[model samples]
Target: MMKKLFLFFKALLTSLLLSACCELNTDNIVYIVSTNDMHANVLNHNKQIDLALISGLKKHYDALLFDAGDAVQGAPLAALSDGDDVISLMNAAGYDAMTLGNHEFDYGQNKLFEHAASANFLTLCSNVYKDKKPLLNNLNLPNEGRYAVFNKNGFKIGVFALTTVQTLQSTDYRLLNTLNFENEVKSAKKMLDLLRPLKLDAIILLAHLGCDDAPCTSKNLALALTGVYQDELDLIIDGHSHQEYVKHVNGITISQTGSRLKQVGLNVLNFKASEKPQVKSILLTYEDLLSKGIKPDAQTEELEQKFRHKQNKILQQEIISLPFTLYGGEQYGIDLSRVTETPAGDLAADAIMYALKTKISSNFLKFPAVAIQNGGNIRVNLGPGAVTYASTLYFEPFLNTLTSKLVSPKILYDIFEHSYRYLNNLSAAGTLQNIKDSGGFLQISGLKIILDPNSKPKVKAIFLDGETTALSRYDTKRKIILAGNDFILSGSDGYSILKDIPTLTEFSDEQDALISYLKHLKENDGFTQYLKAQGRISYTQLPKSVSAYVKIRNFHQQNKKLKFHCSVDGEKFLPCFADKNGLLKFELAPGDHILQIAEATQEIYLNTILGIGIKQGSNLSTIPAVELMPTKE
Candidate 1:
């Protein structure tokens, strides 16, 4: 502890000694270097220091660096060192402080402690507590404080840190154990109350909460804080949700750097030690980093070289060649591989299913026609050229093993229903929870499941290997089926049903399985088609009403004279007219019925058959949902 204080003093003394030549102004300005969700990408970090050095700005301005979580876990380099290497690099980059990101615990509590203990910077978090004690204290590391006061030249700056409440859903519960993250908004307010009396020039919050629009986002915290102590709160730097934005609300400046070290959130304050503090924020892009004359730091280069040289032979080798690039897009701001079918996800699912079934040929386990994967499991997108082992490792670094189990067809339907709760979100709260449930969002390989967007938890139809099956058949005969993956099989996300399924066949690690599967396909010349978007999954919104509805083009509800007739099981056709709801409407016994609609001279003729039986409590969640469509479109 004394050594760190001595080093800090020495640096201060050195800066003071150089002040005559550099002439750093004490009363004019402060620059805050903010980074967030780096995820172990050191390529750009290598050039961060040069931003000040190359421009000779270091001599005039004091830079206070803070990372808003997620420095560990994600890239192969961090995974290779159990997160130790990134900490070393962060130290070399001159980080002053950082908050704990959820992924920092991916390697487990013990390793996380080791990294935190070794870091040159203080790991700050006001809301985290373990077993009635602060998490940092539980590890017996340094600080006995939540917020810190840093004196820059002649100005005093108060800084406190916080993380998102959704970290509970983003990480493994076991890793958390007794560690609890309080509501971020409450934590921020409490911290502000404590820091307000200090009379600091500026109060800064380093938060790992999501950006402006996401649930529990930092903007919510900013609004809550400034609303109580209006001008007292000056700036907020945030992360998580991996977004890029700079927002100002009620006089507080909020900024976030997107993931992968793409940019840095900047806060430049002009306080003359007498004037009202003025603050301005801007997100510096890669070009701006270079425009500022930043050059790569030599030590970071050497550290990166060490890791690459050690793993080069395997990491650089090509695994497979793809015909086209496969990418996953963000749905409602949360990236999901399961919201729709993607070529990359399909190939991954196919490879795993094929590997398990082929390796244990005709054993006791019966593999299902489709393979399942959580949307969150897939990380990287692959492309046209050769995909390397390192790229595959980066795509999926988690050590999730493939587990196979027999879930009755009934249970399988329940699993899909639970997974759909996120995809078919309606209310505001559900949409937010859906953002977290993206991890449990299921991606399939061999079935086309249609969804009704308007109805919550609706799976309109299950086209099993191109054969359409109504919800009634699945309810009648209960058949044992295959479903597993450590994420779902262990009931991690929200699937509590698979926790104790009787029979099971557990296989290799997820990355290893993918490696083996790709190799298996390559060896047999079956790799050509895996890169293209295969139509194994599909989605649709089926119209719903008291009776069968006539399909319209672009929902045109114009009052056009159209003749309508209805029949019950093709018994007889009866005349009908357009109701107030539009087109034509009718109700019959809860059985199969067909309705026909046509213009005066057969200009627009349509026939509708209600195939799916309307049973009590057998809608949406209880069973697969199907829409009533025309026999011929």
Candidate 2:
């Protein structure tokens, strides 16, 4: 009996040991480290995360490193080397893969392909195409592909990338006319169809679709696909809007690290045999890594020091001295260029005007000329004294050349309206509300204007350079030469109307123009003229009155009794009628107004239009026709 009992106990112990060993063999863990919108900040600044830190973290965790995009452009180092410097740092830090950001095209398509060829790691973007062929295939680059399969710890992970469609409007439109950016959702679906057949262990998406007001956001993409491919998609790494967040939607995880190396994203995926896999995302700051005793990788740190030494040699040289500081983002402790005019913006506009005044044609020189700079392009502040090339580069980094076009006063008014379209209104307590800042804000030279937010025409009055009378009274039909950077004049930043306008001339880049302007200032001793705001742009307390015209269209031509009514400043609807040609003319007060058309017997309103700007004492014959449809019973 003792021998039988011993045999049974031995068998049970052996069985338990075998089961434990099998469980250990099946369990697996994989780590993914991601960075996005680094903007060529390879070295740490203000304790922000840098490439050295990213490399160290990758080594500490034994993880795969990836960037979401916008890594190659923005700072002086990247601009000087045409993005080769940043690419070298990335290669040393051991990047596994990266998608394309809109700024990748800032240097043009040829240079973009060169960067892709030079990169050791995979550069994957599934949507961008030229001549109906994938960009990677067209370039014939072996290192660049639409999707790549990575093997980590015996697990096969498939990854693909999608570039934002906004690339058309965000980058140089003139240079990219042949390239086509496929729709994000459609391209994602096609990628899934291709990747799913491989039967990989996991599928990941590296997307530049931001989670902002733009269409085709990361959240929207996940929501659209998760309904059909819920079990297939594991994770989405996002960028482009510069937001930092990690949230799960429809059983899929999405993560993004904010711009300028503000944070690093870590995704951990655990897989077990005969069970569903689990993934969790965490955003780590530089402080977070320090508390955990992580150190920068020695090799990457050395490379960063080398690049810093090179940049400092050129950046430290003084160009000009200023008596007072010129501000772009410093006035409100944030970037207020898109919401209001700044001294830095004014300086940039004036510099462009100065550069083009001599280069333009003689016929255009005779007319009134003005320069406008987009708020997005005015990046940094100028110094109170000893402004260096570094400060100038930081102020305007994109190398955009000067462009000019002849435009009439009507087109000028349209431009002004578009600039203020994104302007936020005041709250009931008389405080300015949070503004949805646009890159299209026009910072001008050679003009002064009054704006009222509550009125249909926000621009109350416009005064030309050195003229006390408004431009409307002083030759409203006269043509003016409009000069600005090619980025804006090429129809970027919501200036679509400028796309078809023929270019009058092209001159030197923005940095050169500003440098020449500064040298002139030094020679002429004109620093005091730009010490503060020049009173070019100001907001008014009360709205201005104007003669407005509306073309009422009645689709039902048989209904002659249909009457039109107008409401000024949200008051009661007053009787309004249209002429035989459907043109309704009226005078508006200095406030918000509404125009409505309805059938009087049924009191059924057919259409209501609000905030249409019609200039006073101008030609009403040019007003565009508006068509309205009658409400069905």
Q: Which residue pairs show collisions in model 2? A: none
lDDT at 540 for candidate 1? 45
Native-to-model Cα distance after best TM-score fit, residue 357 in candidate 1, in Å: 20
Quick one: best lDDT, which candidate?
A: 2
Error of 2 at 472 (Å): 14
Q: For residues 1-633, could you state the per-residue lDDT of candidate 2 as single tens digits?
A: 999999778556544532432222323867889998887867886687889989998887778899889888766678668789899899999999999987787677888888888888888999998888898885554424799999998889889999888766445455576899999999999899988778888889999987863458888988888655767888899997667888898778999988778788878777864334587777777876675566899998899999989988978888898755676653323465676776678888999998776444454467788999998887877876789978897888766657677787777877888987865574332224455677888899989878776677888788788888776733447888889987788778788988777665554457767887998888989866655456587766533444556655452463654466655333477787776666666665432223444432211111011123342245543343456555565
Q: Which candidate number maximizes TM-score?
A: 2
What's model 2's overall lDDT? 0.74
Q: Candidate 2 regions off by >4 Å?
A: 1-27, 138-144, 226-228, 273-276, 317-345, 349-387, 393-447, 450-633
Instruction: Kindly report the root-mean-square deviation of model 1 from the true structure over all alpha carbons.
Output: 18.9
TM-score of each: 0.53, 0.58
At residue 456, candidate 1 shows an lDDT of: 55
